[model samples]
Target chain A: MTPPPAPVDDFDLHGYVDHQLPPARREEVATYLAANPEAAARVADYQSQNQALGAAFEGVLAEPVPPAMLTRRRPWLGAITRIAAALALLFTGGTAGWLAHDSLLAPSAIERTVAEPAAYAHRAFAGEFRHPVEIWGDNEPHLVTWLSSRLGMPVRPPDLNQAGYWLVGGRLLPARGGAAAQFMYQDDKGGRITLYVRTGIIGNSESRFQFFDQQGVRLVYWVDGPVGYALTGPVDREHLLHAAQLAYGQTKR
Target chain B: MDDIAQQISEQIPHLRRYARALARDRTRADDLVQDCLERAWSRLHLWQPGSNLKAWLFTILHNLHANQVRKLKRALDNVPLSESHLSASTPATQMQQLEVKGITDALQRLSEEQRAVVLLVGLEEMSYQEAAKVLDVPIGTVMSRLHRGRERVRQLLADQGQPVLRRVK
Candidate 1:
């Protein structure tokens, strides 16, 4: 016999079965269930199944734990510790190799000769405030002509508009070789970048980029054509490279 | 040592039972209980002196068990449903065998949220509010999931051609 369709009010049935209904509502559902024999039987089955399921898994709570698991450190901690140690070793090895290479190649000796103008440029602006540069960016043509004449070499201040920095000004300083030129630029965020140029006489003529940090300032030194250019700033390496690339591209054009 | 250890020791069995019900593995469940005990021992200051220590410990066990399940799921991507079955230590007796097996199988098929509601309400004998707190869900959600989970289990058992006993009003 097909039993009459169960008149299950989904929400009330849920609330009733879950014991969420108030005492008064609970009594109402109880009365309703009393009238429906088949539904009451189904509810009993549900209650029995729920009880049996709970009993089946409840014994697991009483079981004693082995000592090993209590003391076992998390695997991630060990893996991270090993990775940190390996990274420390790698950093040490790299530093040692760099020191060894520096001593063998003795780039410092060559740097001492070619980098005098860069140092002089650094000292010239070390404590300057309002008027660090001799010629302002407004007099670009005269500034370029004056710097070129003083250094005895063709010089052009790299246009940095594409790199989000506008030309600020230029300064001429005395160096080991002769006159050194410093051109400065400023980005929108008030970050100032300086480019130092001087005559190159060192036999090492190959173009190379070197990263160095002095105090809080970072510098990227490189040689292109005949000019020794040192890009210095407190900006990150990537940003400095981006600015340098823009400057270099403009100079070539 | 004796008094303090005894108090903690007493709660261990209940914690273990809840953990076992949650995890379904003896070793994993016990490990969860141990973690809970150790955590409770260290953070005993957070425990209200006369509050329900059993419930507090069960809450800790539940959180730990849930986290472990999440981590296991992440590690074992595309894991088969059958492999996640709870291996209960209960003997496979003929009388309760079908009911026990059917319930366990149905429980496994439930979503974690639904299973949590069923375990807390059906197994733990917790009220709707208490089960909601343990599962960290709304009381309404608890009721809804419990209702749905129970109906699903009935449907699943019925599909297995279990004898349908008539409801007694």
Candidate 2:
């Protein structure tokens, strides 16, 4: 006579579905499931759920890994670059010290002025193919001079070619009760990002690095001296933060 | 040292998949994965070198997601009348496989505990023991959660008048 059929519980069924059961127990559960159509249907349902989940998210595995997530390649280099750049800026000026020291200050009025408008500007223009900016990047010197004169400060668009983003163009908008400069950049994949800048006395202490997300657009804003800068994009935080650092390094006085 | 980094890098795709299933929002999912990677990188030395790096990374991510959920809940509770409904939208057109849409929505509706168990066992294909270790729970809990979660999902789909997706052996 066949040995008494092994008792199969929900755990056994789940184990069978997940392939976690050993060969012996798996066969036992299979026998039990064959005898019970309800259990068999439940097993099939579980298997389909697993398949659907796998099929649903399989695309992310094939999509290109975000550059910010590439820790294996440039993990230490990112930190070293930031530190070296920060040190370099330290000797050139006290901006680095100010950044670290004044981060504890209260929220600046400048954040209100810069973040929202910058996010709106980026959303409005980053996707605009024909008239993305008032001044195209074809003439860098003229664009810089024009923006600097209008904003009453030196306006330099940080070169993000190393980060795989090329200078697209720039435009000027009214912000912080004064002229604000907006520079656009695009990647080879057609992804666009913007840098918004305005100069104003944001009380006594300036911000370190502030992150704000508005309607899917990411804005990283900070204040240095008389100028407030915000980097806006639909990019990931790491990539956007890296771009912001590059902008910070290049725009230092 | 370099070998460990390579191994960890290889798991990024898996982590991304798991995070996507858990967070249900692409941006939040990537953010969770990024946070996991950064944390894992910083604490690499404490990982005992050779023992199940993927599990370790998943634990870090799971814990981070839990903390974030708790914080978000507290923040939401403080708001008398929140604009939370405004953000409860999904991009329906981006779904490549329309059939799986109901399954995904049903998965998201599961309680966080049940959802975690289902994804860990079902999506990530982790063993009961491995899933329990990552979740810091006993194997019994994992089993019960998986059963309840799967049954609930089936009931939810049926309740919506959507046929339960079937797979024949």
lDDT for each of the candidates?
0.62, 0.74
Alpha-carbon runs more than 4 Å astray in model 1: A1-22, A58-253, B1-8, B78-100, B163-169
DockQ of each: 0.10, 0.20
In candidate 2, which residue ranges exceed 4 Å CA deviation?
A1-3, A73-253, B80-100, B166-169
Residues A108-169 of candidate 1: C-alpha lDDT, one tens digit per residue: 43344334335445545633668868899999999999988887667878988876778888
lDDT of 2 by residue, A1-253 (tens): 9798678988888889898888988988988988999999988888888887887788989988898788443467655654654465468653223232222222323444665567667767876768998989998899999988887667889998877789988998875345788999987767777898876433424446766532233568877776778887666556777888888888876
Interface RMSD, every prediction, one decimal place? 22.4, 9.8
Candidate that would win on TM-score: 2
Q: Residue by residue across B1-169, what tens digits does model 1's lDDT show?
A: 3555566677666666666665554544555666676666667779887776666767777886676455433422321212111121234454466654666766767777777778777777778777777677787888789878788878887797874333343
Best by lDDT: 2
True contacts kept of each: 0.23, 0.36
